[model samples]
Target: MRILLVEDNQALAEGLSTILRGSGYAVDAVADGASAEAVAAAEAYDLVILDLNLPEMDGLDVLRAMRARANKAAVMILTARGTPEERVKGLDLGADDYMIKPFDISEFEARIRVLLRRQAGLRSSIVNYGGVTFDLNSRTFSSQGVTLDLPAREVALLELLFLRAGKVVSKDAIMASLTGFDDDLSANAIEQYVSRLRRRLAPHGLTVKTARGIGYYLETTAPTA
Candidate 1:
């Protein structure tokens, strides 16, 4: 998953980013609300971890601005404010989830998983379709009783494809979501990754269909006799 972390606390931001990266997510973190709002508007993220108390612009203002611009990415408020009114205000501003400060890391991670799954129209941890299964929590991909040995990039790529299964995923979006904010992975590199991932899925009754001048989509198939 690609996440934008908006936290002003340097120590907390570093710790959270490290933990998020360790869990196989591509994260772009910013310190202040202005930077967070700017980045969120300019790019696409699967999730946004926002802090309410912010500099330049208040966190609620940031949320309102994103929603005003119709940015529908899942947002979870991570703030020190632990009040019902604050929680309600965040929700009303289009936050998908709320987490009070001094939170359990495990619980926060679980909430993130839930939001991602919910966004993908999934109601469970495992997404089973077309002879493939993805364990969201474990970040594992398995098929036909065998888990495909895939690199982290390929794993992230496959997850995105599965999330948008039948939809046409533009190459630009794929590149942005799979690579980090500072990554210089070229368009050619993305194509190479897609090619390799295609080969791996082919034997398992799945196909990555290319859309010329566009991107790719996943379709299921059974091996022919």
Candidate 2:
């Protein structure tokens, strides 16, 4: 998943970004609300972790602008604002979840998982497709109770394709969600990863279909002989 983290506190932002990336999320962080708004507008993100007290523009205004521009990424207000009015206003402006600062790290990550899953229209943490099962919490793929050990990038790719499921995900979209701002992966590299992932899934009755000039999508069922 890709996340846009908007926080003015450099220390907190770096810490959260590291944690999120370690958990298999591609995160781009901005220290101001204006940059947050611009970055969020330009990129496709699965979630936005926003801080209210921002330089130049307020986070609520950022949220408002995002919704105005029809950015459907799940927004989470992660700030020191703990008052009822602040929380209500953020939610009224389309924030999916709210968290006050000095919070528990475990709970913060858990909330993010729930919001992302909700954004993907998944009702549960466990996803099953074409005889393969994925546990979102454990971030593991299994088939018939056998756990498949995959490389980190492959795991991220699988989760991305699994979340989008039947939709054709473009190569640009895949690169954006899988690679960070400073990463140096190319389209050919992405194709290699996809090919490797395809082989890994084939034994489990899963197929990764390419859409000609577009991109790729996970087939919903096993291919017929």
Candidate 3:
């Protein structure tokens, strides 16, 4: 999953980014509301962590603008603004969830999982596909009750494919989901990652098929026609 973090505090932003990335999410963070708005509008993300207090633009205005532009990424307001009126206004302006500052990391991560699951229209945190089961909370993959040991990048790639199960995911989209803004990955590298993932899933009868010049997709079943 990809996330855009908009927070003015450098320490907090870095800490949150580390935690998110450690959990297999590609995160891009901006310390100001203006940058956040620009970045949010330009890129695609599974979620946006927005702080109401921002420089250059108010967090609420950023949220308003994103909604105006039809950016459908789920937005979670994380700030010191704990008043009931503020929360209502943020929700009224299109914030998906509101979280107060001085929060527990566990609760914050749980809320994130909920928002992401809700956005994807999934009722459970465990996703099963083609004999492989993925635990969204633990970021682990298991097949027939046996855990699959895989590298972090491979795990992230597999999660992306599993989430989009029956659809063709473009290489560009894959690149975006696997990398942060400052990271650069060549097409060759993407192919290498996919190839590795393919080998790992082969035992489970899960195949990653290329769409020729486009990208790749996980084939749950072979075509009979």
Candidate 4:
């Protein structure tokens, strides 16, 4: 999932961004609330790690603006606000969760998992679409009750498609999800991956449908006449 981390501390921001990126999550970090607000407003992020004290605007103000603009991304306030009033204020401002500094990385990841699962209303680690099953934590995929041997990139593609099943996902979005910075990708390469996936998944009763000039969607099977 994509996340925007708003922390003014350089070291903290870099550390958190590294950890999230290493865990296969798309991460963007900003040291000030202005950049955070701009980035958050410009793009749709799955989560936001915000700090209370910012350079220009307060983190609470940022949260308020986000809510004002109707951005529903999960907001986790990461600050030194341990008092009841501070926490309550942040929560009242539409922050989904709160975390204090000096936090354990392991606990942070665990909380992130819980928050994401909670947001998705998914109690289980498994995501099922048609005959395709994915264990989100393990990064393993199975089809027709058998495991499928897929490259990491292919697996990423599958994850995106499965997550957005029954909805058309634009090719541009897919490219952005799969290709990180410093990686070059071509449109033809994406088509090739989709083609390969189609051939492999067809045997297991899953179809990745293309919408001509639009994008692609996942389905259980080809439509009947």
Cα lDDT of all candidates, in order?
0.89, 0.90, 0.91, 0.83
lDDT of 1 by residue, 1-225 (tens): 789999999999999999988877899989898998899999989899999899999999999999999998999999999899999999999999999989999999899999988988888898886888999998899987788899988888889889888888999888888877877888889889889987888778788889998998888887433
Number of residue pairs clashing in candidate 4, backbone atoms closer than 3 angstroms, sequence gap of 3 or more or interchain: 0
lDDT at 119 for candidate 3? 82
lDDT tens readout by residue for model 3, 1-225? 899999999999999999998888899999898999899878999999999999999999999999999999999999999999999999999999999999999999999999988887899999998878999888899988999999988998888888899789999899998888987889999999999987778888688999999999997653222
lDDT of 4 by residue, 1-225 (tens): 677889988988888888887766777788888888898888777788999899998999999999999998899999987899999999998999999987888889988877766666689889988777988776678965689988767787888888788999999888776654445779999899899988878877788889999889888984222
**Sorted by lDDT, highest first, which candidate order results?**
3, 2, 1, 4
Which is the leading candidate under lDDT?
3
Looking at model 2, residue 66 earns an lDDT score of 100
Better of 1 and 4 by lDDT: 1
Instruction: Please state the error at residue 55 of candidate 1 in Å.
Output: 1.7
- Candidate 4 structure, TM-score to reference: 0.84
Worst 10 residues of 4 by lDDT: 176-185
- For residue 19, give model 4's deviation from the true position in Å: 1.9
| Model 2: per-residue Cα lDDT over 1-225, one tens digit each | 889999999999999999998988888999998999899888989899999999999999999999999999999999999999999999999999999988999999999989988988889999998878999887899998999889888999988888778889998889999977767889999889889988888878887889989999998556343
TM-score of each: 0.93, 0.94, 0.96, 0.84
